[model samples]
Target: MAKKLEYKDLLAAGVHFGHLKRKWNPKMAPYIFMEKNGIHLIDINKTLVALDEAAKAMKGVVRSNKKVLFVATKKQAREIVEQVAKRTGMPYVTERWLGGMLTNFSTIRKSIKKLNSLEKLMKSESYENLTKRERLMMERKKEKMEKVLGGILEMNRLPGALFIVDIHREHIALAEAKRLGIPVFAMVDTDSDPTSVDYPIPANDDAYKSIELIVNYIGDVIEEAQQERKQEKEAQKLQAEENKKRAMDEGADLENAPESHDEEE
Candidate 1:
């Protein structure tokens, strides 16, 4: 398991910082420790507790061999989320979240299929036979589609859960997940509604450092779970091989022991 998150680490990352006091959501009062100057200070203890719960939930989803789609379109969090998703081999939406991405999944899949066909066509010898203008148009389309959907190419089905940076900003993604009954895990800022998500980790969602620390921790949980799943599969395969070998050995022994069976006759 990865090292447990410490209060000092979260402090150093400015995870306790929240929106201005006036902008604070009443629903997040439990997570607000106090007001510092004009801003709300998030409760570090509650942050830790919420983070642990979210981590466990994400671990369970990944260990089941299901995808957890990462959504972070804001400038500060986009790259960080993309890197974590790539490293974990999970799907992500860093550029933009298309409407009906989860609710109308079949249509989105068709678009992905079209992108794939375009790629294959571009790689074939016949691609060169096309006029230059035609090739250019196709190339532009490919680039646009890749920018939007490249991160989710491997996601052939709906994700088991969602890990989002700012739930307020990614409300559309959250709504889609909810519509599909997919669990959502998100960083809920003081201005956001914690009750909207299934797993809400109350923290400073706007700070790059804060988002990075929390998102990285979640990524570690996913990676650890994936490793455990891999180990379990290997062990099961080895056990099955041993059982097959033992059964074959028993069959050989039985074949050789048949000579004494007629002695009673």
Candidate 2:
């Protein structure tokens, strides 16, 4: 579990800042601490609660051996989200959200498979057999597809959960997750409605520091859970080996035991 962040920590990271007064959402009133300088200040306590909820939910997904897809296409969040997601080996979408990404998952899977087949062809001897024009065309198609689907190429199934940055901007992704019954964890800014999200962390979504801080935190939690899972697997392997050894030793002892079998002597 992550250490509880103090008010100063959130403030320093600029997570307490909100949008302009004119852009505030009424549904966010519960999480608002106050208004200062025409900007709505987020309630630090609520932020803490929401952050804990989102972190716990994300950790739960990893602990259950389920995948959580990260989505953040906004300029400020794109780099950080991609870096953290790649490091964690989780799927991410830093580009435009394709409609029906969840609803049309089967079709999307076909495209992913096509990308994989193209990559195999590119590496095979058959690639050399093709004409130069044909090879160039294939390369162009692969490059374009990779830009859209590369991060999620390894994903074979719909994610167990979706962690989104800037909920307002990624509403399409959120809606898809909601329709599919996948849990959603998002950074809900003052202008965004928190009601739509399963777990909402109300904070400054526009600040790079805020996005980086939260994304890295989630990444760390995922890495930790994965490490724990590895250790468990190793422990199970060792125990199985010990059990096997014990069984063999017991059998050997029984065979070596002198039986007072009616010795003819």
Candidate 3:
């Protein structure tokens, strides 16, 4: 079972902190607990609810053996997003959000293919036969591609879901996801519109502590589900082996005993 998120954790991470009063969005009124001085405070209860719902959905995706792409291109979130996503073995985008990343997935895949081919060429002996200038050019290209597409190299298909850090700033990514009919899980600050995402965890999207805490919880859930799925497959394999052994034993007994009875009769 996934760990239940407590209000204390959220509070400690300053997840309840929201944008300045003047920048608040009306749609976020329901999630806003109250205004503190000049800033808005998010409702802790609502944050927990939204988080649990999103976590459950993400777990479902992992159990089904599907990927959830994590997007956090903002300065405060880039490193944290990459670390967490890497720990969970999930694809992530911490650099610029490429337009049509989801909608133009076919072209993106072709690029991934090219990147892979480049890798293979680098690993092959023929690569050593290239001129020094040509090799230097190839190396630079590979490094650039690796920085952006490395996390997603294994992701041949479109992700089952998206977990975005800042929905407003990553709007292009959100739009592409929506266009592809992929569900979105996002960290929605008071200034952002929650309605755009399928699962919106309202909190301080800009804070490093807030994003780290929430992302860590999610990463834990994904890893747990992945472990469970592996156990299930192992159990099924064991059951099949046992059934096969029993059938073989029964056939051997019949063949060894039944012929004698027929001869006596």
Cα lDDT tens digits, model 3, 68-157, are 999998999998889989998899999877787888889889989999999999999999999999999999999998888887888889
Task: Summarize candidate 1's per-residue lDDT along 106-164 as a digit string, tens digits.
Answer: 99999999999999999999999999999999999999999999999999999999998
Score candidate 3 by lDDT: 0.92
lDDT of each: 0.93, 0.89, 0.92
When summed lDDT is taken over every stretch of 10 residues in candidate 2, the lowest stretch is 1-10
Off by over 4 Å in 2: 1-4, 125-136, 254-265
lDDT of model 2, residue 246: 100
RMSD of each candidate relative to the true structure: 1.7, 2.9, 2.6
Tell me model 2's lDDT, rounded to 2 decimals.
Answer: 0.89
Clashing pairs in 2: none
Candidate 1 lDDT (Cα, 0 to 1): 0.93
TM-score for all models, in order of appearance: 0.95, 0.89, 0.91
Q: Which TM-score value belongs to model 3?
A: 0.91
Greater lDDT among 2 and 3 belongs to: 3
Residue 255 deviation, candidate 2, in Å? 4.3
Q: Could you tell me the TM-score of candidate 1?
A: 0.95
Ranking by TM-score: 1, 3, 2
Candidate 2's residue-wise lDDT over 22-82, tens digit each?
9999999999989999999898788888877777777778878888899999899999999
